[model samples]
Target: MKRTKKERQQLLQETISENPFITDEELAEKFQVSIQTIRLDRLELSIPELRERIKNVAAKQFEENVKSLSLEEVVGEIIDIETDRYAISIFDVKEEHVFARNAIARGHHLFAQANSLAVAVIDAEVVLTAKASIQYVRPVRLGERVVAKAKVNEISAARTIVEVISSVGNETVFMGTFNMHRSM
Candidate 1:
């Protein structure tokens, strides 16, 4: 028997509330609907996508506690740091991070993770991504944990260049160079 739209909407809300990190594909499968259908439902409900929701939550949490770093804002946590120009972070690839088949994470997540690390190393209150170049070396499988290390390669009066290296286990999965600008 087919369920009504209201029933589907209620089910979606319950599922999302229980696990806000679930992917659209997973929800589609669970609800016996198409991924596009699920997306439409989310749009109709004024619910942001998984990434946006995560960012919002991170922003809210950060606002509440200014002392703590918003790891979720970058979607990764700093594991180590060397002065104000270098740091390392670790992130796990989950369903919410995947946009396509297999365990490959969305490119934006990789970019954000690297960019956020570069920004975090700055002592200023505002930082922006000026430019970036990223190369995907290998596919990161779902549930695999990866490490991201960034270093300040060069710094000028207005901008800083940072290099990021990401690896899954011992194998290098992605690498990036980010140029960040600090505003006064």
Candidate 2:
């Protein structure tokens, strides 16, 4: 059934609230509407573009005190985070991220997303990945969005253990356990 403009606009707000880093193209696909329609709805609703949303989020993350590393260095757009606990980031696979032949994303991109998230979750002045145990569950193709969630599983004065899971939609595509060293 086709949704009325009001319903679609309401849902759009909710969706963007949940994932502020979402691109207009992604929104168009999700809402099954034209990109121009999504843009018009956004303008009507006073919603900012994806770049602006990300800038706002980057500023907010800085305010939230992501101490270990700069927000810019992280592999994806971090949507939710609290240092020393958990963090969630979104990575959208594009042409450059995937192999030319099969359009499958390279393993290191997912690995970096998880590893950097693990570092970002640590409460420290300096953080480094000492070791990592990672698994690639499936191949992620072009245009897919990978959401990586990092949770600190253990901690000490000098070290920390974080578990990161990267998923495309509901399917797990990558998993990593990172042992990080932090300066006290």
Candidate 3:
């Protein structure tokens, strides 16, 4: 079934609203239209590109929500953050993140993405990772998008335990338990 121009535009707005991280290519594929058409629809609707949208959301959320660190200190694009509760970020493995020979992403990048999210989820003025136990479940290839989700498992007066899991789709690529010191 074909949708009218107005109908398509309305649905496009709804789709983008539902998932701001969606790419133009994904939208085009879902709507059964050219990428150019999605671009045009987004432009006419005054929606920014994925990069700008991520930056805008991260900046706003970091400034208003995160107390442990600045925006630049956090790794990846932080899509959601609730201090002392939970936080989520998306890391795209690029050429710099992967080894040239194997095209597999280095472990440190995944660790950094998860570690930073753990810190960002803390509500204290100063938060530091005192200890971490991590496991690399699978090798993430270049161009894979890593979604790191952090949750505060327990919080003491001077310490917090954060559990972070980084995944590509439904498969876990990395998982870590970070013990953080929160200075009051």
| Rank list by lDDT | 3, 2, 1
> Candidate 2 on 27-80: residue-level lDDT in tens?
999999999999999999999998788768866975678887787898988877
* Model 1 lDDT tens row, 106-181: 8778777877778776655677888888999987777888889989888788888889999988999889998888
- Global lDDT scores for all candidate models: 0.78, 0.91, 0.92
What TM-scores do the predictions have?
0.59, 0.73, 0.77
User: Where's the lowest-lDDT run of ten residues in candidate 1?
Assistant: 61-70
| Reference-based TM-score, model 3 | 0.77
* Candidate closest to the true structure, highest lDDT: 3
Tell me the deviation in Å of residue 110 in model 1.
1.4
- The list of candidate 2 runs beyond 4 A from truth reads 1-58
Best by TM-score: 3
Better of 1 and 2 by TM-score: 2
Model 2 local distance difference test score = 0.91
